[model samples]
Structures are given as structure tokens and as C-alpha cells.
Target: MRRLIGAAVVGLGIELVVLPLWLLPRSPAWGLLLIPLTLLTTPFWSLLHEAIHGSLVRDRRANDAWGRVLAIGYGAPFALLKSGHLLHHRYSRTERERTEIYATGRWASHAPGYYLRLFGGLYLAEVASVLLALLPERGWAALVRRTDRPDTITGLLFDRVRRRFLTQFRLDASAVVAVHLAAFLAYGRYGWMLVAALAGRGLLISLADNAYHYGTRLDASLEALNLRLPRPLETFVLAFNLHSVHHRHPGLPWHELRTAFAADGDEFHDDWFAAVGKQLRGPLPAGTLIASSPGVRRH
Candidate 1:
């Protein structure tokens, strides 16, 4: 309940506080807002992200409910975001068992960097297609559900077409549309820039996320949320910055993370990069200077 309230308050605060500055009259300071807003956007995503993984809710349904709300915040059509993330958990920190899941800097020079960055960009796209083909759609509602999928039935990923349509809903998505509307009337041309800054914010979020949990497991309590990271970057990213710990203890809520970290047992902390390197063959799918042979792909 606290996290839910936090999400509502934080979401509104983001649009209210950050949007205005971006919409304000032209000034050199507007550029600075990008850095801050980029930072601001991280917590918003982290809180809701933790919520979706069931770490923030006592009841599983509540987790599902909030996850839907989070999806709306990101614009709903992201099937890969929901599914891809869960799949990463299913197969964590193994290069040979899972290709391209880890980014120890061992990627082939030939790998399509742009396309690969877009979620298991290769594997899950094929999975989504096969899933759509094979998964049963019962009844008429199911028949009409060009968007529905096994994940929706089991509450994994949101439906397929709904994900796309709702995600792509330009300003018409009721709550989100209202947001864009306010910015449009207020900032006019500059409103788009404010919105565009969120893109940079997403970049930051992804980078920090990779930095925090990079090739680690979240099978126990608070592991992902407790890993060490630079202190200066912590608050800008919010308390949930203790990512490995949070992944393990998903229900801890953003506010409780620090206390949880301090109170956690010996297992809660780790150097994320080093954890994966122990038995890892060669460099990770991404490469690291410490490996034996960078290109020696293991089977």
C-alpha cells in the first residue's frame, strides 16, 4: 500500500515538477533540467519495477495490479520488457546456457548492437511469435484477443496487440493523453523536448540497471538490491539503487531498502561483475579484460 501510494505521488510529481521546467520559456538552464529529470525518472521506474516483480506487494494480485499501472507509465505495448525481464530471471548469469543475457563485454564484433539492445532482441522476438502461434485462445473473447497471450492468462506479459496499441497511443491514452495535453497547452513547441528528455532518462535507467545487477541472480532475499555501487550516484537513482538486494526481496518497498540492506545477512551483498566471472567461460557475452580468451565461445 505504501509503494502504491508512492507510485501515484511520484508519477504525478514527475509530470508536475519536471514537465513545468521543460515547458518554461527558453533558457540555458533548461538543458540542466535534462540531467536532473533524467535522474528523476530513474526512481519512478525503479519503484514500479520493484513492484512488478512482487517484491513490493504482500499479495500477488496487488503486484499484478501495480505492474499494470507501471506499464501504463511506460506506455503499455512493451511485451519484451515484461517477458524478457522474467526470462532473464529464469536463466540468470550464464553465457553458454543463455546467449547474450550477460554483458561481460564479450559480444561478437559482428553482433547487431543496435538491434540487440532492444530486449533479448533476438530470442524473445522469435518466442513472442511462436507463442502467438501456439498459445491457445479460448472462447470469443480469446478469439478477439489478437493481443492476449499465455503471459496474460498466467499474468506474465500483457497481451500482445494491446501492448502495442496502448503503448503507441499518442496522447489519447486517457491519463497519459491528459498529461501530453497539459504540456502541449502550456509549453507548445518546447513540450516535445521535455518529453524527449525522458528518452535520455531511459538510457540512464538501463545503464544503471546493467551496472547494478549485471549478470547476477535474484533467487533469494534482497540480493539484487544490496550490491555495491558508487555512493554519489545512489540518491539520484533513489534508494532502490541497491538493486541486487531488491530483486531478491522484491516486497521491501523503496523506502525500506536501506534498512533492509543494513540488516541483511552475509549473503545479501556482492560485487556484481565479479560474481559472474568465477566459473564463466572466456569473457561474458559482452567481454572483459580479465578473461582467458575473449572469443572462445563455450558450448
Candidate 2:
């Protein structure tokens, strides 16, 4: 509970209070603030991730309530973020969710899309998806019909988009849009600072999202890189650097991840930054790296 509240206060405080004050002066120094603010995203996201997995609190309602608040501050609806993440756990390394691999004879055409998604476009797409909440029920059904495929992430997502879920999605998305819009208005002439900060957040998140699973075996549903980090830094990010443990025990809270890793005799695949850096080598041909077994292995 303390962690959840602390995360909420710090994350929302930076977005709502600190950012507006920095921009109010309209000074060149505003750019300097972006670095630390951007770096703070990892911990903020870690806490939000706890809520998504229903481990932020004991009560389901309270968990989702906190998740919605954090997700709004993060600039996307909670439902959207939760749905996408759960889908990643379900479809990871499959054709639909493998962000760093390309099919034969298609690397050239897909390269632009892959790079865009890796840098900042993924978060931008998440934020922009709020617009879909404006569509009527019939419209959503039509969209599902047009885009759904059994093997694709979108299909699975749309399959779960019943009326109750859609209602909740619309409500949370409205809150997201309203909060950010008000933040921009508050920033006024210095709104560009907010824009830069969001872009930086997006870049950081997109780059890190795939680092855990990049080039891992496609057949292993729960495989992930357990990247090493300095102890202090790992604690700060809520032990999220221990990604393989989280994949194996999705219901475990952030506080328990380190112990779980130790108990399982897990090993780190690489330093966190080194694993993230590997992504810059660009998309690899599908099946370029193969694992002999279904459990965790370094790519």
C-alpha cells in the first residue's frame, strides 16, 4: 500500500505539478528536466505493472482503481494497457507479437515499421488509441470484423471487447484524454516541454518493452531475459529487471520477484543496458537465433 501510494504521488506529482512549474518559466533549462523525468518512467511503469497483475492490492476493485489512476497519468487507458500486456504474455514471440523479427523477403518493407515501433511509435499508438473510444458499439464491431484474425493480437483483443469492457474502456480513455488535455492547456506556451517529455517517455518504454524477449525462442510461452542491474537500481525499478521470474510467476507482486528468482535458480541473461542495446542491431531474420529447449535461454 505504501509503495502504491508513493508511486501514485511521485508519478502524478511529476506530471501535474513539477512539469507545469518548470514550463511556467519558459526557460531554456526546461530541456534539462526531461532527462531525469524520462528516467523516472521505469519505476512508475513498474508500479503500474503491479496493478495490472492484481498484486498492487488484495482487493480486485482497489487494484484496478489504482491501475486506472496510474495508467491515466501514464497517458493511456488502463484497459488498453492491461489488455495489451496480457496479450503479450499470451502471444509473445508468436508472429503477431514478435516486434524484432521479420519474415523472409519482407525485412526491407517491414524495417520502417519495426524501427518506428521500437523508438517511440508504440507509446504514441497507445495514446492515440484513446480516439477509438469515441466510436459507437456498432463501429467497434465493424472494426473487429475488419481487423480480427485468429492468429493476431488484435483479434484476441477484439474478442474480449464485450459491452462491459467497452464501457469501462470508454470511461478510462476519456479520463486519460481529459487529464493530458488539461495538462497541455496548463503548460500553455511551454506545452512543448510536455510534448518532449512524453516523447522521451515513449522512446524509453518502447525500447525497453521488447528487450526481455528479443530473439528468444518462439516456442517458449514464458521465456524472458532476466537482465542484471545494480542492486539499488534494480530495487528502484521494483525488480522489473528480473523479467524471467515475473514471466514464470505472473501473479507474484514486485516485492517478491527477487526472492522468486533466487528460489528458482534463475540466472541473468545479460546486463540490463546491454540487453536493451542489443535491440539497436535492428530486426533479425526470423529463426536467426534458436533455443534447444522451451525454458529461458540467452539469445
- For each candidate, what TM-score against the reference? 0.53, 0.92
The lDDT of each candidate is 0.46, 0.82
TM-score result, candidate 1: 0.53
Q: Cα RMSD (Å) per model?
A: 8.8, 2.1
In angstroms, the error of model 1 at 247 is: 4.1
TM-score of 2: 0.92
Error of 2 at 104 (Å): 3.5
lDDT of 2 at 77: 85
**Superposed model 2: Cα runs more than 4 Å off:** 18-34, 162-164, 291-294
Superpose all Cα atoms of candidate 2 onto the true structure and report the RMSD in Å to 1 decimal: 2.1
Off by over 4 Å in 1: 1-34, 55-67, 77-84, 94-111, 114-186, 213-226, 230-239, 254-264, 267-299
Model 2 residue 9 CA deviation (Å) reads 2.7
Candidate 1 RMSD to the correct structure: 8.8
